[model samples]
Target: MIRSGQRSWLGWLLSLGLVWFGSVTEATAQAVPQPHVKAELIAETTAIRPGTPVWVAIRLELEEHWHTYWRNPGDSGQPTSVKWTLPPGFTADDIQWPIPKRIEVSGLVGYGYETEALHLVRITPPADLPVGKPVTLAGKVKWLVCKEECIPGEAELKLVLPVTGDVPPPSTWTEAFSRARAQLPLATSEWKLGATVEGDAVVLLLSPPTPTEELTEASFFPFEELVIEGAEPQKLTRVKGGYVLRMTRSKVAENPPTRLAGVVVTPQGWRGAGTEPGLTVDVPVEPPTAFGDALTPTAGTTASKPSGGQPLGWMGLWLTLGGAFLGGLILNLMPCVLPVLSIKVLGFVEQSRAGRGQAWQHGLVFTAGVVLSFWALAGVLLALRAGGQQLGWGFQLQEPAFVAFLVAVLFVFGLVLFGVFEVGVGLTTVGGTAMNRAGLAGSFFTGVLATVVATPCTAPFMGSALGVALAQPTAIALLIFTALAIGMAAPYLVLAAAPQLLRFVPKPGPWMESFKQFMGFLLMGSVVWLLWVLGLEVGVDGLALMLGVIVLIGLGGWIWGRWGSYTYPALTRRIALATAGIIIVGSSVWGVSAIHQLPPVASAAATQPEAKSGSIRWEPFSPARVTELRRAGKPVFVDFTAAWCLSCKANERVALETAEVRAEIERRGIVMVKADWTNRDENITRALADFGRSGVPLYVFYPPNGNEPKVLPEVLTPGIVLEAFRETS
Candidate 1:
C-alpha cells in the first residue's frame, strides 16, 4: 500500500531490527553465570612465537566462602580438571596447581584453593607453523566448588593468539601469571625428603639445601588417597639437619607406601620469602636403621642401646645376675639341651668309679669349656651390635648353613652313641691317647657341644636377664653371661667334688650299653627337629637337598666305622677314608648352596586370623602392618617366635593352638601377628630391641585404644591369654 521509496526504507529497518535481536540473544547466552565460580582463559602473551612455548592459564574465581579443590582433594571432594582443544601443531602440557590451604568442613578436612586460583599450562607451537596465521587454544574446564554444600560448574574458554617470529609483548594477565608461578611448588631437588613408618605415624624428614629459618607452621598434602588422616594434627620436631613431621597414618593404609609423593606448605620464615608456600617432593620411604637421631643413644650412654626400663641399680644388677644363673641351671633340663647333658652325665658316672681327683679334674675342664664358649658368644654379640648389626640370642641358628652344620654334628654324635665307633677311634681322640687324657679331651668336647645345642632354648627367667645383659655395658654383659655358664656347670662340679654322691649312681654294666643306645635315639630326634626347622626356612626344594645330604652322611659314617678300625694296607685305608671324606664334604657343600639358592618361604597361610583345622591362624608380622592396624583402632597380638626355639614350639602346641584360645581370639577380633625369627629378619630384630628384650617368645598385646602394648610371659597359658583379652577389652 506504500510508495516504492518508503517500502525500501521499511525493509532496511526490518532487517536491522532482526540483526540487533540476534546479537542480544548471543550476548545473553555467553554471559550466563556459573553456580558458584567464574572461570576465564587468560594468556601471558598476546602472541606466540613459532617453536617457542607460551603460558596459558585457566583462572577460577570462587564466590565468597567458596573453594576449589587441589589435586589431592583430601578425604573428599573432586579437583579441578581441564580438557584442551588446540591447533594441530600446538600441544598443551599438564596443569600446574598453586599452593592450596587446608579447609575443615564439619569433621572432615580438605585441601583446596580459596577465593581465586590460576592453573597454568604450557603450550608449545611447532617450528613449521606459518608465522602469519593465528591459533586458538580452547579448554573445557570443570571444577567442584564448595561452601556449606558443593556445586559443580563448567566453562568453555578459549584464547586466540597470533603466531609471530618475534617475542610477544606481555598482556594484561602477566601479573596474574607471575603470581601463580610464585605459588607453585618448588622443584624436588631443592630439598631432601625422607619418610619412615614409625608406630602409628609416618615420620617425614625434610632437609633443605641451605639453613632454613625456624618454622612456625607447616602442613602436608598427600598426592595419594587414604595414606594419612587428613583431620589429625601433624607433630613437628626440630632435628639436627632439619625438621621431622610426624603425621598420623590413616586407617585405610593397609600397606606401607614405597614412596611419599606430595606437596608440603610452610610459613614464610621457613625457607625464606620466595619459597614460603610449598615444595613438591617424591621421597623414597626407607626402613629406619639405628643411624637416625631417633635411635641415637641417650646422653652418656654407649652405642644405640635403649634403656630397657629403669637403669639397673647395684641390687637390681645382682638380682638379674642371680636370675641368669637360675635360667642357665634350668637350661640343662630343657629338651634341646637335655640329650647332650645326659651324655655328659654318663661321662661323669664313669669317672666317679675311678677317684675323686680324676672326676674333679674332668669337671673343672668341662666348666672351663662352658665359660670360654659363653665369653666368645658375648664378645661376638657386643662387637656386632657396636658395628650396627641387629642381632639377638640364638641368631646363629637363623643361618641355613649353620643349621645344616648342626644337623650333621648331631647325626654323627648319634652314631657314636650307638657304638658304631668307639669315642676315641675316629671322632674326638683320633691322633694320640693315654686313656685318661682321651677321657679329659672328650669331656671338654662334650661341654662345647652342650653349649652349642643349648642356644635354641629360652629357659624361664632367661629372657629378662639376657635382655638386661645386652642392654648393659660390655663388661656387665660379659659378667652376666659368665654367671650363666657357672650355673650350668654347678651341679656336675658339685657331684665331682663330693664323691660320696656317687654311691647313689647305678654301677656301669650291660644296662650302660642299652642306655647309651637309647641316648643315640634321642640325638637322632634332635637331628630330625633341626631338619624340620630347615624345611620351614627354605621351602620344599631345600628340604629335598637336606634329605639327600643326610643319606650321603649316613653312607660315609658306615664306611668309616667298618674300615677305619681294622688293620689294612696303609695306602688302601688312606684312599678309602679320603673317598668317604670327599662324599660327606661334597654333599654338605652342595646341600648348603642349594638351600641358599631356594626362595624365601611364603607365610600366607600363617598370616590369616581365621582358624584352620581347629588351629589358631596368624599373619606374618610386619612393623608397618602393626602400626597401620593400631592406627585403625584394632587390637593386635604379636608372637615373636623362631622355629628353633623349643619354648616357642611348646607354647604354640599347648596354648595358642587350643580351640578355646582360638575361639576367644576370634570373638575379640584380635589381629594375631607372628614374627618368625627362623631366618635373619632385621625387622624382627628391631622389634625385639624395642621391647627391651633380645630373644624370641616375646608376646606383645596392643589394646584397641592404642595404649602401650602389654608384654605377656615367655610361657603362656590359655587362661592367661583370655584374661589379657578381658582386661584389654
Candidate 2:
C-alpha cells in the first residue's frame, strides 16, 4: 500500500513542470558532455495504404546508467506518455512497453530499461484518405529518466507517412519494427481461456504452454484502475503444470460489464484477455441456511456467465437486512459486549424495585445506541466510498493510532470495572455509578462502544451479505444495515421490554463486585489483544508506549476515584489529575506519530510467499518473474494467506504444515509460493475479489503441464492437501 502524505500544490506543479522537464538531455541527437537522452520514431515504411495497419514505433535511447519508465513505473518514477496529433480520420493506439527490469535505488522502485528501448503503437489511416498524399504525425513524449535521482524529460517527435493506394513495403526501419512487435505477448487469438469464481476473486486458467512460464513477469493490467489496481497483480501460480492467476474486484469498483478487460504480460511482452464468468454473491444464509451455494466448479470448468457486477436487486436488500439483524443479535455474545451486558444486567436488577418503566427505558436507550452507531457507521462508509477512498470493513485496524486509542480506552474501562476507579459517591459497581447519574445515556454509550469493537469479527454470513449490500444502491445498503442493527438489538430489546427478566440477575451485593471484577479482567484481555495487534503493525516500541499509556490512565482513574474521599490531599489530587491528563494526551500523540512513521516491514517473516516450490526459496509474486520461471519450465504453487485472516492461519497450521502435504509437494518438485496479504495489498485484494473470494486462506495447486489447477476447500485437511499435490504430480 502506498501512503500519500500531505503535499502542497506548488510542490506538485514543480514536480510536473520544471523539475520534470529540466532533467532531459539528448542521448543521441546531441553529443553533449552532460547526460544524454534521445528520441526518434521508427516505422515500417514512409507510405502505407489507408485502412492497413501500420507499425509506428517510438524509440528512446538512454545513455549508460540512465533509464526510462515502463507502464508501471513502480513507487517513484513517472511512466513515459505520448500525445499524438494526427490528421482527420487517423487514429493511434497506446504505445506498448517492452518488459522492464525491476530497478531499486535509494529506497525507490521504478520499472524501466537502463539502455535502448522501443515502444510500438498501431496506427490506422482512414480509407477515404487521398492517394499519394503525405500526413505528418506529431506528438510530445514525457518520461522520467532516473539512476539515483529522477529527472523528467519531454521531446517533440514526428513521423511523416503517405496515404497511398499501394503501400511501399521497402523500408530501412522494417527490421527494427519487426523486432519490437515480436517482443509483445503471444497472440491470444490462438489460446483458449477458462475461469472460475471462488468467492470475491476470479481465478483464470490459461491452457496449453503459455508462450512463457514467467507468469510473475506478466502483469494482468485491468483497463480501469477503479476496477483493478494496475500496480499490483495477484501472483500467478503454475498449477497442474498450467497457470492460475488470482484477481480481485477493485476497491473503487463500478458495475463492470459481463467481460472484465485486462492485459496479461509475459517476459516477451503483453497479451490482452478478458474473463466474463458470471459473478453473483452467495445469498444470505438463514437459520435453515437458505442461499445460493457457492459456485465451486472442478478443473476445466467454463464459466457460463460473468462473476461480478451490481448486486441482486431487491432480494439482496432483504438479505442484507436479515444479516444485519443476525449480526446485531450476535453482538451481545461478543467478548467486548459481554462485560457491558453484565453491567447493564446488574443495573436492571437494582432498578427493578423502583419501576418497570425505568428498566424498559434503559433497555430502549441501549438499543437506540446500537442502532445509532450502526447508522453512523453506514454514513461513514457511504461518505468515504462516495469520496472515492478505498476502504473496507475493519478499516480502523489499518491505522495503528485508532487501535492504540481503543486499547487505552478498554484498559481504563477494565480498571474501572475492577474497582480501580469509582464514579459515583458511595457506589462500587459500574451500574451503580451510571445509575446515580443518567443510566439510560450510560447504557447507550456502552452499546456504541460494543459496536465499535465488534467491527473486526465479521460474522460468518456477514462478508457475503455486506459485500452485496455495498454494491447495491444507497437505499438498499441502508436497509441491510438497519436489518443487521435490528438483529443485534433484538435480544437487548426483549430483555428491556420484559422487566421480569431482571429477576435472573443475582442480588447486587458483595458477589456482584467479584463478578464485575472478573468481567473487568475479560475487558483487559481484549485490550491486550488490541495492543498486540497494534504491535504487529507498528513494532514492539509502539506497543511499549501503549502499555505505558494504559498504566498512566489507570493511575489517573485510581487517583480521580479518591478525590471525594478522605484518602488524598487536595494538592495531591490536583497533581494526579494534571499528570493523568498530560500522560493521556502525550501518549495518544506519540502513538499516532509512531504509527505514521513506521515503515513497511519487508523481511521474509513479514512477507508470506505465494507458492511454495520444493526447497527453492519462495519469493514475492511478480507477473514477470512468474512468466520467466514458467518459461524455464518450473512449476508454481500459490498459497494466499494472511496474519489476521483466521481461516488462512488455521490452514497453515493444520494442513499446509502437515508432513504428508509437504512430502507430496517435495516429491513433485513444485515451487511453493506464499502470498501474504496480512496488510491490504491492492494486488492481493484484487486477486481475492477476482476469484470471487471476499477474503483469504485460498490454495491453488499447479501441476507441471501448465493446464488448469485443483482448488482446495476452505477448510483444508492433510489428506486433501496431500491428494492435491499427488493428483497434480
Candidate 3:
C-alpha cells in the first residue's frame, strides 16, 4: 500500500488546484543538456506506492553508432555510473545492469552498449509519508560515449511521482523495464560450474544436466578485474558430456581470485533456446588438476586428453576411430570427390574385362596410393601445427596458389575426358598397357587424386575424430588418418578382391567412347567449380590472368593432340611435344605467381557482429526475430512438424484450428509459428536441436515472465496448449 497520511479528498482537490504552481508532475522526465545524447530519469510506476518498491531508471538515448560502457569498461574506458540525490526517508538500491556487448575500436576491446540504455534501480519509500503529493527522485549520471572519439557526458535527471494509497498504474516504461530485466544475466542451477587455474590460463568447467553442442565460440565477461584478458579469445570446446572454456589471464593479475564472477553470453542460450543469452557465473576458483579427473564424464561425457602427452583412453580411441571411418565414407559423396567419379567407374568397368589377378593387383596399388597420400598430407599438417602454424585441415586451400593449381589440374583432366588430348596413364587402372588408356600406375595416381580432393570437406561424424586426432601426438594422429584412408578405399578394395561383382559392367563397344566423353564433361563441371573458388581467392584481375593460363594450356593440349601421334613424322612430333611442354610450364608459373600476390577480398568486407558466429537455427521463426522478441520479453510458441505426418495435420485441425485454443494463444500475447518439415530442411533440424529433439511434432512455449521455456508433449491437445498458454500470464 501507499503512505497513509493523506488528508482525504479535500487535500487532493487543493493540490490539483495548485498543479501549475511549483509541482514537478509531467509526462516525461527529460535531462540536463548533454551533447550527442538524450538522458532522463523515468519510473516504471505511475505513482509511488509507499512501503513498496518502484523501479526508477537512468535512460540514456545515444546518437547513432555511439556507445556507453558497462560495469567493467574492459581495456581503455570508464563505465557509466550514477549518483543519487534523493529525498530523506527514501532509500535507493544499486543499479541492476543488463548484459553488455563487446566493442572493439583502434585495437582496444571494451564492453558496452551501442544505442539507448537503461540503468534500473529500485526505490523504496517510507510508510509514514503524506499522500496526494509529488516525490522528486533525482540522479546525476556520468557516462563516456564513444565512436572513434570518446566524449564524457553528465546529466542531472529527475522523475516526479505522487505518493498514493491505492495500487498504482504501470507507467509507459513498463515494457522497457521488462526488456531491461530480460537482458540481465540469469542465475541457473542446471549447470554445475567451477573454475580452475591452468598455468597462465583460466579454465572454466561447466557440467550441464545433459550433453550440450560442441560450441566453437562463447564470451565470458568477468565482473571482477584482473581475472581475464578481455581482448583475448575464450576458446570453448566440448568435453565428455559438458564443456570447457579456456581464457587468457590478465597481465595485471598477480594472484588468482577466490572465485571467478562473470556472465557467459551465447546466442544459443546457456539454459537453451527462448531463455536469456546471458548466464550468471559465480563459481569458486581452484588449483589445476589433470583432465582425467576434472573432466570425468558426468553422464556419458568425459574430459578430453587436451594434449598429446596424455592418452585419449580406450573409449575415446574407439569413438574417434568410428567417427573418422564414417566421415571418410561420407567424403566420397562430397562435392570435391565428384569430378573423379566417372573416371573411377570407367576403370572399374575396364577391370571387369581383365583377369582377376590383375584386378586384385590394381586394387592393392590404388589403396597404397590413397594411404601414402594421406600419410604425406597428414605428416605435413601435423609438423606445421607442432611448429605453431595455427593451422587446421585444408589449410593449404587458403593459399591462392593452391587453388590455382587445383583449377589447372581439374581443367587438364576435363580436357582428357573430352578427348582434347591423352596421357599415357589415366588415374584409374583399366585395360592395361595394351589399350593406352589406364595402367597400374594410373590406379595409384587415381588414389592420390581422391585423397587430394577429399581434403576440402569435413563431413558428418568427422568433427569429434579429427578435432581429437590433431591434438594427439604425430603417431596417434596418423593412425586416425590411416583409418580414414582405409574407410575411403574400402569399397574399391571390396570390388578388387571380388571381380565377380564387376560382371555387371558391359563389354567395350561404341557406348564406351560416348561414356568416356560424358565423364569428361563431368570433369569439366568440377573445373567450373574450381574456377569459381579461384575467383573468390583472387580478385577479378587475378581471375583473368588464371583464365589466360588455362586457355594457353588448352592450346598446348591441342598442339600435342595434333602432332604427338605416331602418324606425324618423328622430328615434327618431337618439336610439337617440346613446345607444348614449354607453354604449359611457363604459363602455369606466371599465373600462380601473379594470383598469390593479390590481397584477399575479405580484408575490405564488413564484419558481422560476434553474436551471429554460431550455427543457431530456428525453422519457421527467424532466428534474429525470435532473439529480438525474446530479448523484449515477449511470449512465443513454435510447432515443429511435417505436413507429411498425418498426426500434425490432425492436431492442427482438431486443436490448433479451434477458436478456443486460438483465442487463448492470442490472449496470452503469444506469437505462434509452425515449421514445415515435409521436405528435409537443415534449418529445421538445427532448430530441433534447441529442444534436444531429432524429428518433427515438437512444441515449445516461451513465457513472457522470463521463466525457462517449456517443451510440451509431442502429442498435443487443446487442453495441453491452453495450459501452456496460461504460463504467459
State the local distance difference test value for candidate 1. 0.74
Q: Each candidate's lDDT (Cα)?
A: 0.74, 0.59, 0.70
Which digits, one per residue and each the tens of the lDDT, describe model 3 over residues 130-171?
A: 877788888888999899999999988888888777667677
TM-scores for every predicted model: 0.57, 0.50, 0.47
Taking the tens digit of each residue's C-alpha lDDT, what string does model 2 give over 1-729?
423543556446633443222222111122212246777865666565778878777788888889987776655567789899888888999887655555556644456687777899888888787864557777778788787766777877876655556434445667887666565544344334555544456555554445443232234543323544333335454444345555664445554324544445443322333221111111111221111221222222221111122234345456656766765566455443543454555445555543566657766777787778877887887687555445555555556777777777777677667776655421322554335335555777767776776654455455555555565567777777777777777776777688686666665578767777877777776776677677777677777777777776766776666563447887877776677667666766776676667754542433544436543346675434444555466666767664444455557778877677677666777777666554555455434433434344566766667655666765678888877776766
Per-residue lDDT over 1-729 for candidate 1, one digit per residue giving the tens place of the 0 to 100 score: 899999999867754544443233223323225887778877787677899999988888778899989899998899999999988977989999887887877768888888887899998999998974667778888889999899888988877666666666666668999889888888754567888887778878876677633443467888888888987767554445565677888888788777888987774423565554778768787777722644221111111222111235577689989999988888777666754755675665576476778778878877887888888877988899766677898877877777788787778778777866544622332222232776777777777777777866677788778877886778888989998888888887887688778887686577867776787787788888889888887876777788888899878777767676658677766776777778777787777777767776754335444546767667777766776677678888888888888888878888888889989888989988888888777767766765556887888888897555678887788888888888877
- Stretches off by above 4 angstroms in model 3 are 1-309, 426-438, 603-729
Which pairs clash in model 1?
A: 606-618, 607-618, 607-619
Error of 3 at 506 (Å): 1.0
Q: Of models 1 and 3, which has the larger lDDT?
A: 1
Q: What C-alpha root-mean-square deviation, in Å, does candidate 1 show against the real structure?
A: 21.8
Model 1: residues >4 Å from true position, as ranges?
1-313, 338-342, 423-435, 567-576, 593-599, 603-611
Which one is best on lDDT?
1
Best by TM-score: 1
Candidate 1 vs candidate 3: which has greater TM-score? 1
